[model samples]
Target: MNKTFKIYAVIFIVVMVILALLEVNKKEVTDWRKNFDTNEKSPFGLFIFDHEAKDLFKNKLKKIDQTPYNYYNTHKKESHNILVVETEVDTESWNKILDQVSNGSDAMLIVSQIPKEVSDSIGYYDSEISFADENVLKLTDKKYKNDFIKLDKFPSGRGFSYIKPQVEILGKTVEKNNSDQANFIKIKFGKGNIYVHCEPLFMTNYYLLKSGNIKYAQDVFSYLDDKETIWFVESNAKVSRFFMRFILSNPALKYAWWVLLGGLVLFVFFNAKRKQRIVPVIEPLKNTSVDFVKSIGNLYLQEGDFHDMMAKKAQYFLNKVRLDFLIDTQNLDDEFAKKLQLKTGKTIEMINEAINLIKKAQDPYAHVMKEDLARMNKLLDEILK
Candidate 1:
């Protein structure tokens, strides 16, 4: 490497060393974000519940990553209760899920809130809102009125005011002194029922690990009559995430990775430059007018066609006289020769000789010699000059 490249390398090493030191010395804190990933080990993840749910459904719990619409669409002949705990479902998928419920599949939506399109389709407006703390979850049935789960700090809160006749009240959220709000309900869709519970945080690993907290979730799910239930998670395999984390934790490996990436970028940048080809030198075309006249003159001399050559000379001389001196040589008699001598300021002898050559060339029966052609050219040149 050169001086500039070595300086950049030193700067990069220093930055990487600083980043590694900061990563090693940083304080560890608990991650309370609600992920609910099947493979995640976070407090809010469903890793614990996913393994334990097999016993509740009698070894018939099938975990899948597809949406409710996709699962039910593929397995049209068969039916099973579906559990959806994911956040932010699209309107089309929500409608398709309800269609599957109508066909014959009890779907439990344990989410933070119910979608407005679903509520509007069912002829009511119902959704959940996040509450600060001290929320109580209980069923609406008279006998289970006293049986309730109380949380000192929870986020699930909200219920609908207007209830349609087709809706069956299942559960309620009772705050400290506030009136009861229907947080959970069941709607009879053609051959099946759709259960909507707003308290999804209770089904996480944090709550399930607590003493007797899993029973509350079990009691809420006891309403489903299907022997087997299909749990929908995201479309991802339960694989190890330690390969990248292991590389990033070591300073040497991380530095090598960054250096390799930079080398590849530099290689591409240098190779992608525009290249130009060499332009060749071209000579101009030769003047062919003089060569063409010389070739025709040689051919005429070899053929011994002295009359044709003399005729060409006569035509050229007459045209020159007409253009330069404005003299007419149509008849080429004594009158024309006089006019030519006057216009060209030549002697009468040269003018008379040019006129005799022109008249002899014009006659078809006249025989011409090479000497006659040469004399005619000499006389015309002297006169025209």
Candidate 2:
């Protein structure tokens, strides 16, 4: 599969596993109840509302209307319970709601995409922060100060306001504030609590079907187990804006750009500095004799000058016979012709006739008989033979 498909496949498998665990745990709880419909009509299938969670915690809670920030909002004033789950939430909305709940005795929990501003806000509200494994949670001991301070920090260091809760961090590599985790954090505001989870896959409808953290989900919304709870689910454009930030934060993209730059630099360096090798050049030989003869023949033929071509051929044959037999043209007798014939293995009459034909010139364009040209050609061939 292509890389993108593989990534999507991996995400799909992880979601399926979480949903499977949720489903399996769901079947085990015969007393499980559902109150709100999360899948009322969502295209992304990111948020899943638990009506059972609201029913189990009935009377003590109220599901709030989903603002332009939170994905799922459920509240329990009696139990001081407020649970917020979403892919992301706005800082202003979060702060306003936290301020409202902190004034009272309610607890708030938020799950969303993390921003530096949100992290700083969580730190502002909580006294103790601890990070362990890959999870971070902020705790405050305003109401139960004694119980909150005793929590141990991982690796025996001064813990931040947030503490790692349940998951073990040993042997697990934590990517430095990577966007892959979906930027999740939890904090306590006065008597209330707040949580921010980066990736919503852990709480999506597909994940709730088979999530292994049924107890965690229960604990998260546990205040609703005893009283009436409100389940509010929604999608906001503001929360989705954080997704763009998350995508741009990918380290792979940064590294890919760096690699391309490096490759371009190397290509320029090698091509610019390297010299091309020089080699000896050879001149090709030319054949002029055949070319010259063919040129003359073509020119004569184009002008319909057959007499000139036939006379040239006859003259060439006469020069060749004189050189081969030492023939004298001064004798002008059949004896010289006979000697030329005997030496060259040709008849005397053929030689004499070829000579006569070469010496005589006639009009080439005249309506000459075809038989005359044929006879001349036959005599020339015999003389050459």
C-alpha RMSD of each candidate structure in angstroms: 36.6, 40.2
Worst 10 residues of 2 by lDDT: 148-157
The lDDT values for all models are 0.76, 0.46
lDDT tens string, model 2, 1-385?
Answer: 3454455556757986987777656543221122113543232243344445544465455555566244323332343444555424466666655664566434334333344555565553222222332342212223322211111112111122334453211111123452212123345556555554333333434334553434334444433234333333453333332223564567887677668767855555555555568977888788799999899767876887556656566566666767765776555466666666656677667778755565552344544333555567788677666
Candidate 1 displacement at residue 51 in angstroms: 1.9
lDDT of 2: 0.46
The candidate scoring highest on lDDT is 1
Q: Can you tell me which runs of candidate 2 are displaced by over 4 Å?
A: 1-37, 40-48, 59-61, 66-79, 87-91, 105-112, 115-117, 124-186, 211-213, 223-232, 235-385
Model 2: lDDT of residue 29: 24
For every model shown, what is its TM-score relative to the native structure? 0.59, 0.31
